[model samples]
Each structure stands twice: as structure tokens, then as C-alpha cells.
Target: MMSLNQVCPYCDITKINKDIVSVDHLLPKASFPVLSIFPDNLIVVCKACNEVIKGETIYLPIAHPCYEEVSRHFTFVIKENNNNKFTIEIATNSKNSKLINQKIYNFIKLFKIIDRYEKYMTAELQDYRTAVRTPNKCVFIELGQLTLLPPNLLLKRLFHSKFQPCFSY
Candidate 1:
């Protein structure tokens, strides 16, 4: 399981809170029974994405977001004609091109992550636009300065502020 502070390794969202909808099998447990209980094979996911994307058998060769190096397998494409709609497209250089394509197709159908997350992402993007237009005071101070904090100081502060006493130590 990922730490609470860690974002969804798949969707790369850090805003996930206690309402953590479900556990995602990083390597679809149905296909890889041996890895079912593996720690790295599980991740926390928002209810919306989890409920929509799991529990199906499609003979696609796409790597799990957590298990496979997604950067090399897919790229996010914002369609120019679809009101900037975003979709993940398979990389042409992917070793198992056919399987990857199939996986991508099936994964989208299974998860319905496109339309669901698209609405959320669109709202988020709008928020970002608003932020850019009128920056928030708190965010402005922390934006580029996060890297300037000392490593120990950052760790201590993050743990102390974000976690319970057990994690704080």
C-alpha cells in the first residue's frame, strides 16, 4: 500500500483523501495470482476510478500503471478537435505494440476513466487557469520554494503536519 501522502501511483493525483474508494491491483491479481498479496502490486485509488476500471479479462499486453513504466508505454494526448479532450495513446515504439494497443483499448472501456476523470480533470484544469490568473497567496510562497527547504526540515514538517503521531516520529 502506498503511504497516505503518496499520490495514486497510477493517476498521479495527490489530492486523494480519506474517502479512498478502493484498492487497485497494480498487476490485475486475477491474471497474476502469485502476486495477489504483493505489497507493490496494490495501490489506493479513488472510488470513481477503482470501481470503473477493475475485474475483467482482456487479452491486452499493456503494463499495469504501477508495475510497468508508463512513461515509455503511453503518452497523454489532448485532442485538438474535441474541446481539448485528453486521452492516453500507446507509444508506437512499444515492444508489444499490438498487445499494448489492445490493452489501452480494453482498459479505457473497463475503467470508463476517460469521461469520468475527464470531467474532474477539466474542473482541475479550470482551477489551474484561475490560479494562474489570480495566484493564491499561500500557493505563491510555496510554489517554487519547495525545493529550497532542507531535506530533513521538509521531511520533519511534512510528517508532523500531514500524519498522525505514529508516523510523525
Candidate 2:
């Protein structure tokens, strides 16, 4: 219960805001009414991952985030596209069981995580570029004025913020 609340375990990217957080039945209350209030059955997620895509959808016999370790099932890899934008993709290493693979697949598809992450990264990259190209301010200071989300974190991680056209963070 404590582990599921601060960050969205489902998407791994969204920082949980108290105002927008949602309680998701890891095992849906709709199907497993007996376990409806079970402590282990609930997970906290961002609103987009919960109400928007995963309402009432259930996948059983899979690696539950509460029961099984998530790193054993999927990995996040961020890549730069040919268009000079960034995108994040899940790399599911080869699993011994086909069912395990399906669980990972269903999790990714239902949450639309790949697209969501790509969108975030894309916007961040654009902002970083804009900040660097700003005339008077330092890229760091300029980006601070641009958006609240930390672009420098991913910017530093992927491209190391070594910009050719603009200043580095």
C-alpha cells in the first residue's frame, strides 16, 4: 500500500500529484469482488493511466506489480528518432513463458505507455531546443521559464545536453 502511492507504478514516468492520483484495483474489483478491498489488490496510478485507459480491464496470471517484481518483466529505453526527437520504448527481454510475454504486452497496450512517454520526451526535447536558442538567457534559466517538468533530467541523460545550436544545461 505504501509502495504504490508516491509514483505511478504502471507507467514509471509520471510523478504522482496528490490531486490527480487514482486508486486502481490491480485485480479489478469488478471481477474479483471478494478481494475488492484487499490491501494487496490496489495500486496507485496517475489519472491518465487509471481512469483514461485501464478502467475495469483485467489481466490475470501475470506479473502483478505488488506480487512480482516489475523489472523482471520490462525495461524502459529512450531513443532519439530520425527527426531529432526523443521517444521511450519498452524492451521486454525474452521470457521463458508465453503467458508472461502476453501479460507484458497487455500492460503496455492497455496503458498506452509507449506513446505517452514518447509524447513527453518529444515535448521536452522541443523545449530544450527552444531554451538553447533563446537570445539572452542561459538555457537552464530560459527552460525554467518555459515549463515546470524537468527537461534537464532526460536532456542530460540522453544527449548529455551537448547542444550544437544552443547552450547546454
Q: Which regions of candidate 2 deviate over 4 angstroms?
A: 1-5, 76-89, 125-169
Q: What digit string (tens of lDDT, one per residue) describes model 1 on residues 43-133?
A: 6776555665555444355456665544344444423235644332333344656776676555555555445445544544444334434
Q: What TM-score would you give candidate 1 relative to the actual structure?
A: 0.48
Model 1 residue 20 CA deviation (Å) reads 1.3
Candidate 1 wrongly placed segments (more than 4 Å):
26-35, 38-40, 52-59, 80-96, 123-169
Weakest 10 consecutive residues of candidate 2 by summed lDDT: 143-152
Worst lDDT run of 10 residues, candidate 1, spans 160-169
The CA lDDT at 3 in model 2 is 51
Q: What lDDT does the true structure give each of the candidates?
A: 0.49, 0.64
Candidate 1 vs. truth: CA RMSD? Answer: 10.1
Q: Give the TM-score of candidate 2.
A: 0.63
lDDT of 2: 0.64
Q: Which of the numbered candidates is closest to the native, going by highest lDDT?
A: 2
Candidate whose TM-score is highest? 2
List TM-score per model, in order. 0.48, 0.63
Q: Write the per-residue lDDT of candidate 2 for residues 1-169, one digit (tens) a residue.
A: 3653465778666668778888888778888999889887777788878898789886655567666555466655656568877666666766536877777777777777678767766766576666566776464344323232233343343244443343344
